[model samples]
Target chain A: MIKPLTGNYAAAWGARLARVGVVSAYPITPQTTIVEKLAEFIERGEMDARIIRVESEHSALSAAWGAALGGVRAFTATASHGLLYMHEMLWWAAGSRIPLVMAVVTRTIGPPWNIWTDHSDIMGQRDTGWLIMMSEHNQEVLDSIIQMFKISEDPKVFLPGIVGLDGFILSHTTEPVDIPDQDVVDRFLPERRQPYILKPGDPLIMGNIPSDLRDNVKMRWDIHRSQERAKGVIRDVDREWAKLTGRSYGGLVERYRCDNAKYHIIGMGAWVGDMKEAVDILRDMGYGIGLVKVRYVRPFPGEEIAETLASSKGVIVFDRSVSPGSAGPLYLDVLSHAYIHGVRVPIQNVLAGIAGIDVGYDDIIGGVTMFINALEEGRWPLPSKIQWYFGGGEWWP
Target chain B: MSTERYLPLARPVVGVSGKTGTWRIERPVINYSKCIKCGLCWLYCPDNVIEIVEGSAEYVKIDYDYCKGCGICSNVCPTKAISMVPEG
Candidate 1:
């Protein structure tokens, strides 16, 4: 059914269609309505599931993890401070290889007390062993949520996942989303298969300190291998879902107008849409550039990225979150992939939307224009590798 | 990196921490004559090492492998039947 829904509603519908067994989340701004609508679904009997009202995000994820451990598909959602509060459990849920899904409406981490959209919240969890996906539209958000269950529950990738949408931008904005039929989703996402199940009489011990330190390190390596293997599983699942639902996101990284281009622009989440617009405007002006939207951050499409960078004269990367001491997180991932793939090219990082400041196509066009001019003037690897773009005609080159 | 198993799941086994009682400075000794058999020590045990042995000659049994000998049982015993004796 096609209906006008916000990103939060799309997530709730995604979980509803996936036939999740448990929904546990603490209500935070921009994320509260997601659980509220879910509670409505349960109260109205439209969906058969348990909505656990937890006191904090920590307990919320724990409850979902517990439910998943019991051979049930589980889900949860949180943002900003709530996500940080659940940080400790993040490693616990992933390190244990629990199969579940979470909707992380990305928000700015605060000290100045902001609740706007940015990648900082979800980006912070990149190393936590969960499949991270950032979507461009409300439909993609809904679709990715269902696909995540399939990817996460796959035996090859038995790890939890987070489907991220920019705060307020997607969460509150209304757009028409084609909610996948429950029967079709059921066919695509079969009955969930968990690694272990908890039974009352038959006891299973977990989380105990290992006698050998190697045993502890082995678990981390296993997760690493499974994550690499998930790259194929993600593509296969996307193809399967496309066959079933007539929608495909071009696998991990979606390339647009990248053919015969000398330069490429890269980013994730809602801003990628704006980047596309900026790329088009630049293209019309006779600039040989394209946009590469990173849909899946983990099990990163590094091979595809390196392939594109290998041909391009120069590439520009936009990051919503920075690693503080180092460069932007997304930039670092791209550079590492470029390094390993032996793709040597002039690439620069643009730091924008750090605390949810609005970044429109205008900012992208101007900033990228300067980059293109620099590359054309043989000013490759211009003075510094990073630039700060803070909208309103202000950016440091 | 791992032998037989790939995941971290383990079966509930004894002496997981390897005879933790060796770290205890004082041990609890129960006097059967003044014992109330209240099961308070069993309930109050933090490590769950104490068990109420109904028909055994000893009033209660403690799994010393996991017991830290923290003297929790002696402190909670109301009948004054349990004593924390220094380790020799």
Candidate 2:
């Protein structure tokens, strides 16, 4: 069914279609609507599930973890400070290998106290052992949430996942989204089957401390191996979704207009749409520019990114958040991928949209123009510095 | 061996590696004379290590292999038959 829905509503619909058995959530901006919709679905008898109303995000995720551990599909949603508050349980969920799905509305982390669209909240959890995927549109938000369950519950990758959408940008904005039929989604995503389940009379210990230090190391290694294995599962699930829904997001990273491009731009989430428009304008101006929208940040699509940007002369990366005293987290990942693959291209980092500053197509086009100009003027490397575009500063040293 | 590392489905297998009985600084000793065989200790053991032997002289036997000696069985015993004594 086609309907005008916000990203939060799309995610709620996705959870409903997935037939999530248990939903535990605490209300926070942008993400509150997603859970509120779930509550409505449960109360109205539209969905058969338990809505665990928790006092804090920590308990919210913990409840979901318990449900998932009991061999049932579970989901939760949070944003910004709420996600930060659930940091410890986030590790618990992933380390315990619970195939739980969480929708994170990416919001700015506060000290100055602002609620706006930024990647800092999700980026802050880069190493938390959860599979992270960002959505560009409301449709993708719905589709990715459904696919995340399949990917995370795959035998090769029994890990938790986080589906992130920009706070207020996609969360509040209404757009036309096609909700996949429940039967079609069921065909694409089967009921989750993990190796172990907590059941009465068949007792098993979970998340127990290992006696030998090597066992702990082995557990961490298993998580790492599963993360690496998830790359394939992600692609497989995307293919299945495409066959079922006629829409595929090009696996890990979606490339646009990069066939004969000399310059490329890379980013994740809603800002990638703006970058695509910027690329179009730059292409019309004969700049030979393209855009690579990184859909999955965790299990970083390094090889695919390198292959896509192999022939480009220079690439510019847009970061919505900073890593403080260093470079943008996305920029660092791209730089490492480029370095390891021996694709010695001049890559520049443009730090924009920090603390929710609006970054339009014009700002993106300007940044791309600056990078291309630098490449032509024999200053290709641009002194290896991070530039703050539309961030009230020229560059940070 | 694969089960030893991040056990699949996170199912905790029995008697695999660690003998949690080593964690017991104080072990529970059941005084069978006062034991009513009410099975409260069997019901209260968090580790599920208490087994009730109906026909034997010792009606209750604690599986020390996995018991951490939490004293829950002692606390739940109605007749004060189970006492947590310090390990020698």
User: Could you report the DockQ of all the candidates, in the order they appear?
Assistant: 0.63, 0.34
Worst 10 residues of 1 chain A by lDDT: A375-384
In TM-score terms, which candidate is top?
1
TM-score of 2: 0.88
On residues A191-266, what C-alpha lDDT tens digit does candidate 1 reach at each position?
Answer: 8887888889888887887878888888888888888888999999999989998999987999999999899999
Question: Model 1: residues >4 Å from true position, as ranges?
Answer: B1-5, B33-37, B55-59, B64-66, B78-80
Sliding window of 10 residues with minimal summed lDDT for model 2 chain A: A388-397
**Can you write out model 1's per-residue Cα lDDT over B20-59, one digit (the tens) per residue?**
9899888888898888788999999999899888887687
lDDT of 2 by residue, A303-358 (tens): 99999878989888889999989989999999999889988887888888988998
Can you list the residue pairs that collide in candidate 2?
A: A196-B9
C-alpha TM-scores of all predictions: 0.94, 0.88
Candidate 1 yields a Cα-based lDDT of 0.90
